[model samples]
Target: MNIWNLNLRHLRALTSIARLGSISAAAEAINLTQPAITQALAKLEIQLGQLLFERHANGMTATPAALLLAPRIERALAHIASQRVTMAQLRALIMLADHGSYATASTATALAQPSLHRAIGDLSVALKRELVDRRGKGIMLTDQGRRIVRTFRLARAELEAGLTELASLQGVETGRITVGAMPLARARLLPSAVSAFYRAYPDVRINIVEGSFQELIEPLRDGELDLMIGALRDPSPGADVLQQPLFADRPVVLGRVGHPLSLTSVTISDLALYPWTVPAPGAPLRVQWEKMFTDADVQLPNVPIECGSVITIRQILLESDFLTLLSPDQVAVELEAGWLTKIADTPEGLRRTIGITTRHGWRPTGMQNAFIQLLGEVAL
Candidate 1:
């Protein structure tokens, strides 16, 4: 087997697709667009000289060829993960050689200058790969260095998890647990638990990336972030994802106080008659909303704007009769401020369980585990 033939991106993309089942699901899992994922898959298929998937009604499923290759791919992935730590060491060496005692920066930086250089040098020599060479620009990664960094990201994450695990066992706290979550959760759910976790483990760092549910899933699945919390939908059943329902969130229809429908005593049919800024199609809430309308013998109107942004929905509400359906958590500010009020006291068929997701068999680091535990503790 031309072991050098398999690159990290190829293996990861394949694994993601095999796990999730569709290119679209894999894209969501890894946070790439459908086009980018398709291209990656195409390239990997070409490199491997075999079709990896069979397109299906729900999504794609791995082919027998893919199944046969799984074990070898996994083994290679494991080796790449080990090589990555070594690669980090080499890159660190190169970085230090160039930056030279960058002690000029504040002491609290995540990676110090000296440690970076030594790590890089050690990695390069250990790999027997001249990842960098001194040139007029001081130093540059050789052709191999570029490839290593390009494809080794996931493996690097594995390396990091291993290192973090070891340090935790030694009772030497590592750093922050990074979480990728939608803006509403960041605002409402994370603050309290994160604050408490920080107080108890002062040395553990905490980081957050805020986006819509669609935006956060890829980061979480790719191991870039520890976990994500949002409306629990089955992870694109085809994308190899594992989800756990953490809490239930009520569905809400929202409008400014002055909106025409704000106090109209609207029935489900009344909702379908109005212009709406709906959540994008395929999302669980949107699907549920459509089903509710369909059940009431109404077709969900043509959505002029379909988005996942509560802020934008709120802005649309302020200017026009355009209305929105949101998770209760999302409209907390506007609701409390009296800018938006409910059309009804209760929204039937609008509530859903919020779920947390991670890679199927993926485990969390100590910090990640701490944050997730805290999130569950402070759930509404």
Candidate 2:
């Protein structure tokens, strides 16, 4: 179901009724008439197709559906943190923040530009804060606007999760999991887990977005991604993210199968003689590559190409004498095909932890948890 179709005020009324146990008390709490609160509850039940409350002689008793949903609704509202912000305002601002232009946001939402503009203007007035600023041909979100957008995204996630749980209760499994995958995870870990998960929940959709850690972190924080899988950073990426190590991966020096360095034993001095292709600066692989030279007391080698793409690096290695440090898993196919060979292990058996990263307090639905369990099983 499209959660945006439901009224935020009605959702608030539902939570209030669940807490207060009577229509009169709930209406008094949210400043609505008793009849209005009753209508809101009835409308919510009809929309959700579940009996939210059981009428009794003394008061209303919440059904299982309401028990599941009320806390989610309360948490979502806490993220919003504003009694004055309307659903229309939240939708408009989020669209503008995501698309970066009123015209594009209008096209995306199928709303008239004037309506979007009015909604944003009303939102700014209600919140008593500036959300957007005109810059050249477009507008940009203020810092406050970005913070609001993040919270709104999280709120939407909570509601979507609640709906997913409700659907599961009805024996209907539904929801999407967006995963941010770095190179190592893409090569084997993610594919194995996804295949196992699909066999169990065929109807759920899984989306894998491939990028470096720098590229995927923001989306993971903003609730655009369910989780990220890749090399774990040394000093946690931030206070808001949690990392779980699935396994340890040791990198190898890769070269063309017939390259000069393909000997059984290779030295750092031997490695320094060849031109290298490494990931861009700040990448975990690049850091390990640098440390290899430092530990051996050898000057860093000349890196002719700084790249993060395994395919590009593989093609270059096959065509020329460029060596790179990579997890063997990343080049397993090339090794099996005899297109590339591991020249040597990284110095001192340097290893990076491969794992999952997620928002610190994320609460995954049952399907999501099952997928995570599958990842652990596949790792084992």
Candidate 3:
């Protein structure tokens, strides 16, 4: 409770144990040895006068004390993470306000580093103590620094929003547009959209990032990515956003050369029995695969392999009997090369939709509009 004497390493160790389930796992999470983790936990318990976890055969089980503390610990971490966004936003605001573009401060004062040093110096002087402990890699955030960052991000977002709104709207769609997408789409959807957009209006600068669908939701709400595109299975449209129906896309079953299925006119049932390579659960293709076998009255055999990339899946399928399911669009090359053969009568209803989405009040730039149109053309 005493911020002056609190040890962040100990707090981090306790958080790791709560998350990773054991002292050993916690050590792995924090890059420390098991004994170091054990020592940190012991030190924390001594400071707090409470046991946070119960050692168990299965794993470390959270005590009531730990369970109550978990949410607080996670909130603290979230606060720390927000500092990164805050710092970035603060720097961006300074550049936008002064030079019109991010490159204006290119000469110096990048990413708010100078501002941070000034703030730290001011604080150290005010407190009559040295706060920043700079190391070989980077300066570690003192507890006070962490607290400052947590609050700072909220204030920064508000300030940035106002600055963005007032800073003389350039092209159109005056607010931020954050997009979330998968890796394959990096080559497919992103570049096309960016090009189609810039061609129409050169001023619509977008902040685009790539990640899995699961990782995109929080950012969407945090006002990061404006929209998300990627194949998601069994998408439960949440109350705040509407998930419009996109087109059902085509999926093909793939097998390596010399697979028994390759020689056989593999039935859906036959395809289900072999060792399979598959997309991770929740991928659009994986969902289609599960639905296909079930629709044909077949139970899915154990899939021993997981592949996230279409190219990797194709190579594995061609080299061995590893049956992989892929979107036909993604595997046109493999099918043509004879490296992969369709093992089953590629089922219906396993197609992904190419669609555009926006938040309820989301505005689109000319570029965003042009790109969405182009996506429709390519997808259709």
Q: What lDDT tens digits, residue by residue, belong to model 3 across residues 251-349?
A: 677776567877767688787778888768876767777888888889887898887766677777767777877656566676777777777657655
Highest-scoring model, lDDT: 2
Q: Candidates ranked by lDDT, best first?
A: 2, 1, 3
**How many clashing residue pairs are found in candidate 1?**
18
Cα lDDT, model 2, residue 362: 92
Candidate 3 Cα RMSD after full superposition onto the native fold (Å): 19.3
- Judged by whole-model lDDT over C-alpha atoms, candidate 3 comes out at 0.59
**What's the TM-score of each model vs. the native?**
0.62, 0.97, 0.54
How high is the lDDT of residue 259 in model 1? 76
The list of candidate 2 runs beyond 4 A from truth reads: none
Q: What is the C-alpha lDDT profile of model 1 across 1-380, one tens digit per residue?
A: 23224455556667788877788777777677888778877876776566778878888888766765554455437635542444345334333333433342213335766666566666766667877667764556677875555335445455456445545655767665777776456557777888889887888777778776778776665456777776777445435577777787777777778877774668777777778887778877788678777776777776898877777788888888776777666777878998888875334545777767676666566677777788888884
Error of 1 at 345 (Å): 5.4
Candidate 3 wrongly placed segments (more than 4 Å):
1-114, 117-179, 183-195, 198-208, 357-360
lDDT of each: 0.66, 0.92, 0.59
Ranking by TM-score: 2, 1, 3
